[model samples]
Target: MTGSHGLAAAQKGVQDSGNPTHFNFFRSALRGRQRVLWCANDPTVCLDREKNPWGGSTCCYQRFCKDTMSDPNHCGACGKTCAYGFVCCNGNCVDIQNDARNCGACFEECPGQSRCFYAMCDYGG
Candidate 1:
């Protein structure tokens, strides 16, 4: 959990209402009187804590991965972004910047890695 993408902001301690164990996922954003909505038994995304230069929170979090409730690869997970650049393929995280289906966004190729073709290997298409 020490990668560059780890949820460092969430390290601050906070009150865990009812289910205390699972509140860590969003504890960082709910600080300083910020109201939060706990969906289901636990939630990964709380309220917006990042204020723009204009001092306003984006109420909607298209960029915040934790807000995608139905995205299996990202849901209930904080700061854990889908690798392959945000495409879901066969329940696997794919970086669309080079994935076959999302060649640029849906399909991307990892550096020095070949596409899995017919149990064979090739540099790239």
Candidate 2:
């Protein structure tokens, strides 16, 4: 049997020769026999590290497999985006709000002897 989701099922059991009991058993088993094959070519299919030879696990996003952990366009989840000038860090967008290297803005670093506080560069002690 074949499914629209690219799944194929096949019978898996001992073949019947001429025994009546075996034939009956096989016939009964056949009704509940099914094996599904997971195809790698399917873009909508999600695979784990063991099933996927590329690397780690991946999810289906926009008809493609994406690792949301680092993808800026799909950080943390599918269709999740990072703002402009923000960098994807461990599935979260960084470089904004109290970040010293991007104080008040993207890449707007704090000056010497100063730090970022509340999204602004503070130069006081």
Candidate 3:
């Protein structure tokens, strides 16, 4: 079977393992096919191998895997929130403050005719 198909079949047969973050999939051989084993809570096995094979990166938080380095909601660490007008910049939450690109708020860019200053959208030329 194709990888996606196999993943779908495995997911369909998943069994909860008491822990909210843990799951197990057991699939018996069908028509002489080999058995399949899937572990949801294993970062190396499930996340690194299956979910993020290329990136091979993940962080667990509240029963979910996250990329704390860039995720604004969990920047640097889980539950480390960024304010509405701020963003996760290199693992730290930061507001516009002095950024011309995100003037006054996250993703709020200053117009070409103006410059950003003191967290305001428009300022001196």
By lDDT, who's the top model here? Answer: 2
lDDT of 1 by residue, 1-125 (tens): 66654555344433434445556546555563343333333222334344222112212334332333324344334334465435554335655544544344323333454553422234345
**lDDT per residue (tens digit) for residues 1-125 in model 3:** 56899888766655433333333222222522321223346644424654554233345555555656567877877578888867786567877777777676666777775677888856544
lDDT (Cα) of model 2 = 0.62
lDDT-wise, the better of 2 and 3 is 2
Q: Model 2: how far is 44 from its true place, Å?
A: 7.1
Index of the highest-TM-score prediction: 3
Query: Model 3, clash count?
Result: 0
Per-residue lDDT, model 2, residue 60, is 69
Order of candidates by TM-score, top first? 3, 2, 1
**For model 1, how big is the CA root-mean-square deviation?**
14.4
Off by over 4 Å in 1: 1-80, 84-91, 107-125
Query: In angstroms, how far off is 103's CA in candidate 3?
Result: 5.3
For model 2, the stretches where C-alpha displacement exceeds 4 angstroms are: 1-45, 53-57, 96-125
The TM-scores of all predictions, comma-separated, are 0.23, 0.41, 0.42
